[model samples]
Target: MKQLRVKVTNAVGLHARPAAVFVGEAGRFASQIRVRNATRNTPWVDAKSILSVLTLGVEPQHEIEIMADGPDDTRAAEALQQLIASDFAGKI
Candidate 1:
């Protein structure tokens, strides 16, 4: 298992397009990936679920935590970190 925190850097946060990118990337991994806001009450969401990510209502600079567990967990977490750090730029 692996976990890391990242800030949403996309000008509009993880809106439709960026969330789609994220979900696509997450789907490539054999690992299970989840993302969620740091706020305690929020539930962790499937990284492949665009609707779930949108429900997060992420905003610029909002910190999110990514968690992965499986054979590809490390790669999954790293890729997700890059996605967040890039503000979902090119990947979008």
Candidate 2:
């Protein structure tokens, strides 16, 4: 398994459109990915599910932890880290 912790810097944090973008990016990987709101000390949730991610209640400046386990775990973790690091960039 691979894991990373990153702070959310987007204006709206992970909600609505940003949540959708996050879920979409997570779906692109073959690895099983999970995320949790580190700042909130929330339980891990399915990164591919919008509902699950939304339950995290992530907000701007919140720190989140992501984990991936599978053949592409490393890439999956890194890609997600980049996505959040870039504030979802062009994808949002």
Candidate 3:
């Protein structure tokens, strides 16, 4: 398993479009990915599910942790960390 923690800097946080972008990115990987709102101390949720991620209640400046376990776990974790760190960048 691989894991990373990153702070969300996007204005709207992970909601609506951003959440969709996040779930889309997560769906690209073959590994099983999960995410949790570290700042909120929330339970981990399926990263590939829009509703699961939206329910995280992530907000601007909130920290989130991502984990993945599989053949591509490392890449999966890093990619997600970068997605949030870069505020979704070209993805959104």
Candidate 4:
């Protein structure tokens, strides 16, 4: 498994559109991606599922842990790291 620690930079956190974007990005990879609000003490959720991601209740300034397992895990982890670090390409 590959993992990354990223801060949520989106103004609204991982709600709605941002969550949708995240789920979309996660779907591109063959690996299984999961995310948890590290700053909050929440259970990890499947990054590829919008409902699961939204349940994370991630907010701006929240630190998150992302884990990717299976083939392409490294690439998947990096992609999500970059996405969050980029503020979801200003989509936030």
Pick by TM-score: which candidate is best? 2
Question: For each predicted model, how many residue pairs clash, with residues at least 3 apart or on different chains?
Answer: 0, 0, 0, 0
Cα-lDDT of candidate 3: 0.94
Q: TM-score of every model?
A: 0.92, 0.97, 0.97, 0.95
Candidates' C-alpha lDDT: 0.87, 0.95, 0.94, 0.92
Root-mean-square deviation of candidate 4 = 1.0
lDDT of 2: 0.95
Candidate 1 scores a C-alpha RMSD against the true structure in Å of 1.4
Per-residue alpha-carbon lDDT of model 1 for 1-92, expressed as tens digits? 99999877778888889889988999999999999977544789998899998888887878889999999999999999997797675766
- Backbone clash pairs for candidate 4 read none
Q: Residue 26, candidate 1: how far off, in angstroms? A: 0.4
Tell me the spans in candidate 4 whose CA falls farther than 4 Å from its real position.
Answer: none
**RMSD of every prediction:** 1.4, 0.6, 0.7, 1.0
Clashing pairs in 2: none
lDDT of 4: 0.92
